[model samples]
Target: MPRSPLALAALATVAVPGLDAYDVRRPAQPGTDYDVAVVIDAHRRRWVVRAPAGAAAGAALEAEVEVLDALAEHTASGALPFAVPQPVGFAHLPEGGRAAVHAEIPGTPLRVDALQPGPGLAADLGRALAALHELPTSLVENAGLPVYEATEYRQRRQAEVDEAARTGKVPPALLRRWEELLEDVAMWRFRPTVVHGDLTAERVLVADGRVSGILGWGDTVVADPADDLSWLLVAASPEAADSVMEAYQLRRTELTDPHLQRRALLAGELALARWLLYGVRSGNTEVVEDAVAMLEDLDEHTRSLDAESSATYA
Candidate 1:
């Protein structure tokens, strides 16, 4: 359904807060079921309002609060090197509602489409990620943070695939291919580390050819680092992938386990599957097609890896 004219007009004409929403054209696509308001008040204060379903609102708000607390702890300890968005205030909605208000960062989001290749971009990303991972995990956990688990990942993937199949939006071949890919259970046992959990193009912000910030910690977790690496696999050009791996390896030198590689690759596949499902619900063809293409590439790669593993065993 088309957006209501009044809503469209309000979105177009209303001044955006903190940073210019003027440049923020309507997301070429609409977002999920949440209501988003980027508003700036008379004092030139800018903030973001994320209003999600009240049913999951409490849990979601707690999650956001945990992220903010993590950032704050990092900031206080001088460990958070990048410019992460900070929460200004949180308010409880009447009648069991949930919303978080955040102080908007001053720069435009570093979109993946505009990413330029350079010698250090990968290293920059790797180093920033290292900074994130290097922080004391114990401290964060003491504050009662959540970690994304393999069961959750599998269940989420299954839900999306099921939804697409039920709607007849997913091709049978694609569904079959994904099912075949799921037999590689060894890919799920990599070492656990801090992960942003939802590392996608939208969550990355770049400026001056360097990674200025990483956003969307709402789904952040102390899970396998491979979960975040999946985004790099998706975003980096094939040629650039080697460079990213090199940089990541340079900072994290102990990743010799084949299981780690498998986990990371599987995580990439899971991300693709989830996006495909999301595209089905949102009716976005670009997202759906790109996700499908990525999944195919990943399947081919995984097959090659399996062959290599078998040969090594022999």
Candidate 2:
């Protein structure tokens, strides 16, 4: 088997010329077990290195490799359009097991600056995501990866909440929100599409006014395309998000599912809950702090949704 993504991220950080002096940091948010190092090169080239840690260490590494392989297969077969991580030399760590070097794509993460909905950026990104979703469903089915319907996703979170309760990892406020959100997600239904599993602004790389790279394929899975679209919607302003959805609809007409918006909201909550879990387990302060904010936002949204659903029927 090839080297894991966690190993690749570590090696990539160390191998980059003149980046050795910068302090390596942990994940800046909650429910994330990845160790992130922000390095500035001698010429002031900034890059980030993220490796999985704790029990997540080995599984994350392996998952990243699988994601790359899946991307390669899809890209070669003309089913996918994004550039995936290419692994170089790797190391074997006792804790994380394997670390490999990844070719650094040139671009800044999308979340760093204020995002404007340009004429084509949103459409381009949305369509690109759609292409990934358009892959052969049977192939993914054969792989036995978890397919996250909204209910399934919520159930997983409930399971996590139960785990947290047993372990004393979650606070009462967050746990209540988790329960409320799970109830809301149970009523949702959308057709399945391949999801990025970990869709966020940080994972998207943009350059020269366009999206140049989409990074972090470790969380790839088959699920609702709305899960992937949620990032674009959440990160962009409403107008920008609308433009993006319009562009996406033009390229991949299948994105017109009625349940799109609902699933998007659910996905965001799920992401927040996940980060919270990561923070608790890894003891990352930033992750824990962010999880609090995420819990609040998710709580409000879930309540709004529940009210809206009740109003619609009445």
Candidate 3:
């Protein structure tokens, strides 16, 4: 069961000594493993309180706290342009779990569809992502976060594709397309970089039309940078994506992979497969049905494109 906002507020008071009173309210719908709320103290200072849904999530929360601490202490001087959550306090729950408080980052979540095609905000977001990717891998490594080589990451993705295939639900054409991409050795060649492993649009925050903050660091890892770029390819408009890529390329110090955009697109496509697998594994029939509907839609779209190409050639 999830903890109430009021309950989390009480926990915040205990965790962060010096809060005589505060108002707590749910900020957004809870994620799979957390119940999140915003707490406004008597002095009008704001903070985010996150309580774990289970023991495994509690462990992840602790790990996130550690990562935030490391970033605050080690990387503050050369910090990226945007803000990351600062770990301020922690508390032990009555149910023997744990909760944490982070200084509130001031911004609303990015809504890609609502954005128009221009260099301003899009470029800022790209540059911010570049900064994050360019961060020294040592920070994550020393903090004991998951690190992987390009080949290793590809192997993991292949394994997931294989597992999804075994479920006997993924469409044959989609499976074949995914397998071909996975087996293309040249396509998988790239240096691993620090990545915000679960970088959906919602995790990116905007203020005054620029990226002001990034949230949800629990999946931080040293892995394929394409994972970080995948969301933008799907969510951002073509002109906006072009601007973003231009800024990202200009900002990056290291050699950018030529096939990075291709792989990012592939990653975006595979996300649906992962969603399907997750729904099946969790025994959520509704989710599974939804994923199936998406798969069918993808199949129709792919077929239409193929027909158009063949007609053009003829």
Candidate 4:
């Protein structure tokens, strides 16, 4: 069960000594593993309080504090183009975890449904992501985060595909397509860099039509740049997605893969497998069924596209 805003507020004071939280409410970003609240101190300063949902989440939250500190140092030396949560204090939870307080960042969460196609917020989002990828890998490495080479990354994806197949729920066609994509050596060729690893619409905060802040850093990894771009595909406007890519490509300090977009699409599609696996492992029938339904829909959708392509070529 989730903690109430008031409950989290109480914990906030304990985390940050001298914190006088007079008002506490919900925050804009969703918390999958943390019970979160926005606390307003006597000085009208906004602070965020998060209590971990489980032992794994608690561990990740603790690690994230270090990762943010490392990124914060880099931001001080060079521009990162956006704000990240700054941890100010921490307190251990009675539930065998921990809670922390952070200075709140400005801006509302980005909604992909409401994006402008031309170079505006979309371009800002692009540049923001490019800046993150451009950061030195030493920051994440020094902090003891996972770093992977191109071949290792490919092998990892292959292992996931194998696991999903074992569930006996994934469409055979989708499985075959993923396996073929994983086996394509040319598709796997790209420079590994620091990635946010779990980017989504809610993680990006926007204001004045520009990306102002990013939230969530626990899943940070040094891997394919395409993993970062996968969420941009959720943009309602194809032109907006294109704008993001144009800005990202322009701002990047190194050469990008020729098949980056294809790989990003592939990455997005593979998320269904992860969902299915999570559901099966947890014995959540509703989630497992939901994933299966989506898989079937995707299978039919892709097959129709293939049919149209074959006819077009013939």
Candidate 5:
């Protein structure tokens, strides 16, 4: 069961010495693996407190803290464009984990569906992505984060698809399509960068028409930049996605990687395979069925598009 707001507030007091909460409440969305709460201290300053639910979550929390510390150290000379969570204090949880407090970063998470095709929210997201990808690879390396070259990244993705295929739950058409996409070696050529590996609308915060903060850095890694853009495919409209990509391309310091968008599309498709594998491993039949259905839908959609293209050319 998720912890109560009162209990979490008490824990927050313990985490931050001499801090007295004036009020406390549940966050907008409670986390699955962490008991989280928003607390307002005596001076009316907002803070977020989170406690891990298990060993794995605890380890992830520790890793995130280390990475945040490394990032702060590396960016001491003012490199980052937005705020990242930094643990202000910590306390051991009684149930065999730990809780940490962080001052609440400004702004709510971006509403991606509302993004439009202009120099608006989508452009801000594009700029945010460019800023993150522009960060030095040494920052992630110094934090002991995972790093992967293009070939290695492709191989890992191929391995994941192989694992998903073994489950026999994924649609055969979708599997074949993914296999072909993965085998296209020419599309895999792009420079790796330090990416916020688990980027989604929820992790992106916007305030005053710009990205103000990024939350949850546990999945930070040096890998394919296209993987970061894949989330936009699912969340934003096509026109908005196009605007975001155009802005991203304009801001990038490197020469154009012509295949980046195609790779991003492939990455978005592969996410379904990953979900199916997770469901099969965890014995979640409902989720497995859902993933299979989605994959089938994507297969049908792709086939229709291909047929239309062939007809148009003829």
Candidate 6:
């Protein structure tokens, strides 16, 4: 059962300091692992409270708090253009777990499908992503986050594909395609950098035609930067994606990786495989069936494109 917003608010008042009066309400839809709410104090200061939904979620929340705490101190120099949420307080829940409160960040999450590229929002997102990827690797390392080299990351992805294949649910063609991509060593040779490992469209916040803030820092790591670009490639319009990639290349300090775009596309394609694996592991039949249906649709689409290309050449 889900926890009540008012009950969470009552917990927040006790956890947070000097909060005499406040209004609490559900924020966006609850995340898979947590329930979140917005708390507005009498002074109009806003804070977000998040509570874990399970034991695994509890551990993840703790890690997120640590990462946010580290970033808050690390970014004091104001090197980045966007804002990152800062942890303000914590509470011990009656259910024998922990909850956290973060200072509310400005701006609302961008809807990728509805975005209009004319306002330069795409470029703003690009620049923001570049800045995040370019952050010094020491920050992630110092925070005790996971770091993966090119080879190790590729191997991990291959392992996931293999795991999915073992379930016998993934289409053989999709499995073959993913295997071929993962084995292409030439395409995997890019320097690892700091990455927001779980950058979804909802994680980005926009205001005034600019990326005002980025949320959900729990998955920060040192890994292939292409992982960060996958969501944009898969979700945004072609024109918007092109605009973002152009801006990202212009803002990036280092030479652009030759196969970055290809790897990013591959990452997007493999996301379904990951989802399927997650569902199987979690014993969620609905999620597993949904992923299988998506994979079948993708296989049909790929065949249609192949036929079209062959006819064009003929």
Write down the lDDT of every candidate, Cα atoms only. 0.60, 0.63, 0.86, 0.89, 0.87, 0.85
Which tens-of-lDDT digit does each residue in 1-314 have in candidate 5? 77888888998899899889999989898778888999999999999999887888898888789889877754455566678888999988877778989999898888888888899878878877887898889878877779899999999999999999898777787788889988999988889998989988888888988888898898889999998999896678999999999889888899999999888888898999888888888999999999999888988898899899999999
Residue-by-residue lDDT tens digits, candidate 1, 214-265: 6676666667777677666666676566666656666663555465545566
Name the lDDT value of residue 138 in candidate 2: 59
**Candidate 5 regions off by >4 Å?**
73-78
Give the per-residue lDDT of model 4 (tens digit) for 55-164. Answer: 99998997898899988876677679888998998878887878989998888889898888887998988899999999988878988889999999999989988999
Cand. 3 TM to true fold: 0.95
Q: State model 5's lDDT.
A: 0.87
Tell me the tens digit of each residue's lDDT in model 3 across 1-314.
67788888888888899975458888875677888888998899998888898888888887777777777753467558888898778898877768888888888899888766668888898899999988889878877889999999999999999988998888898889889999999999998898888998888999999998888888889999988998998888888898888899899998868999999988988888889999999999998888888887887887798889999999
lDDT per residue, candidate 6, 160-279, as tens digits?
A: 889989999988887888888888899999999989888887888888878888888888899999999999988899988888888888889998799999999888878999899889
Arranged by lDDT, best first = 4, 5, 3, 6, 2, 1
TM-score of each: 0.66, 0.66, 0.95, 0.95, 0.95, 0.94
* Candidate 2 local lDDT, 102-155, one digit each (tens): 545677667623755757666667677777777766555555566666567556
Clashes of 6: 0
Displacement of residue 72 (Cα, Å) in model 4 is: 0.7
In model 2, state the lDDT of residue 181: 52
User: Which scores better on TM-score, 4 or 6?
Assistant: 4
Clashing pairs in 5: none
Model 5 TM-score, 2 decimals:
0.95
* C-alpha RMSD for every candidate: 6.5, 6.8, 1.6, 1.5, 1.5, 1.8
Task: Give the CA lDDT, 0 to 100, for residue 141 in model 6.
Answer: 83
